[model samples]
Target: MAKPQIYDVLHREHEEVSELFHQLEEAKGAEALELFARLKQKLVPHSRAEEAVVYPRLLEESNTADTTREGIEEHKQVDKLLAELDAMTPDNEVWQAKIKVLADMVGHHVDEEEGELFPRAKQVVSDQEAEQLVDEYARERDSFVEDIRLEQRDAAE
Candidate 1:
């Protein structure tokens, strides 16, 4: 079987996060907490993995650098929002409102990525490289996720 491409990996994560955000919107109290945790579990590591494996490669081409940089900057903004969301109590009146904003930000970012970045990346990154990066991205994301699970388990214990 053919291995997945980097676009496939990132796009799949984007869809999953979008669905999780929808679930989060309907969730309350502990459900919201659980859903938010799951969202973060996917998002943080995905951003880091993209940075580690994809962005630098895109940075190699002068033309793609700006878009690559913009994508990273967007991730930074989302991280800030995620941190703010993390700080608020689930019961806080503003929490859901702020989460809606976060969801919009993420949706816009994903649209830019899939619409522009991924297509442009095909020109910059060779087929072989894209395939290799998929595995690398997965490893980086999974390791970070495992660490998060460990931390959460320790905090609960």
Candidate 2:
């Protein structure tokens, strides 16, 4: 089998998060909170894994450095938004507004990653390096997700 490209792996995650955000926007009360938890669970790890496996490589390339730095900063902003949502109940007056803002912010981030970052990354790495990065990204992300799942499970219990 051909090794999966980093673009496809990241894009699949983007779609999953986008779908969760859609579900979250339509949900109310506890359901919204539940959806938000899932989004946080998925997103935090995905961003971390990208930073671990993707960003550093791009940061090393003068051609890709600025965009990679911007993407990293955007991830930090997204982290803050996730934290703010986590602190509030879904029924809070501002919860819905915050969710909309997060969705828009994420949508913009995805556009930049897909349109600019990925194309530039493609130029910076060889086909072999791209494939290797996909493997590394998947492993790193899955490990983080499992750790988060255990924490959530322990908290619930």
Candidate 3:
């Protein structure tokens, strides 16, 4: 069987994150907090893996960098919102507004990536290279998850 492409994995994760954002919007109290936590859990590693593995590769190979650059900028914006949300309690009105902004930003980011960046990337990267990237991205994602877990544990102490 052929290995799955990096785009396939990333795209699926994007869909999952989108669902979490929807859940966040509908949730209340502890449930909302839980959904927010899950969003962070999925997003941090997914973004890191793209930054660590995918974006640099695209920068090297793709002459058209506009889409990828936009994606990176979006990542920074999302990171800022995530940090703000982390510092806030769900009970705060401002926190809810901030989360709504995050959801909108993320939705736009994912649309851009799926619509533009991935298509451009596919033009440059061969299927085999895409598979290799998938492997590397998965490994990076796992490492990121471990690091975040450790940080959370330390923060809780």
Candidate-wise lDDT, in order: 0.91, 0.93, 0.88
Name the regions of candidate 2 deviating beyond 4 angstroms.
Answer: none
Residue lDDT tens for model 3, 1-157: 8789999999899999989988888788899888888888899999999999999988876554777787889999999989888887888889778888998999898888888888888899999999999989999999999998998899899
Question: Residue by residue across 74-155, what tens digits does model 2's lDDT show?
Answer: 9999999989988999889999999999999999999999999889888879889988898899999999999999998899
User: Which stretches of candidate 3 lie above 4 Å from their native place?
Assistant: none
Residue pairs in collision within model 3: none
Candidate 1 lDDT, 79-131, residue by residue in tens: 99998998987899999998899999999999989998888889878888889
lDDT of 1: 0.91
Clashing pairs in 2: none
Pick out the ten consecutive residues of candidate 1 with the lowest summed lDDT. Answer: 117-126
lDDT score, candidate 2: 0.93
RMSD of 3: 1.2
Candidate 3 lDDT at 53 equals 94
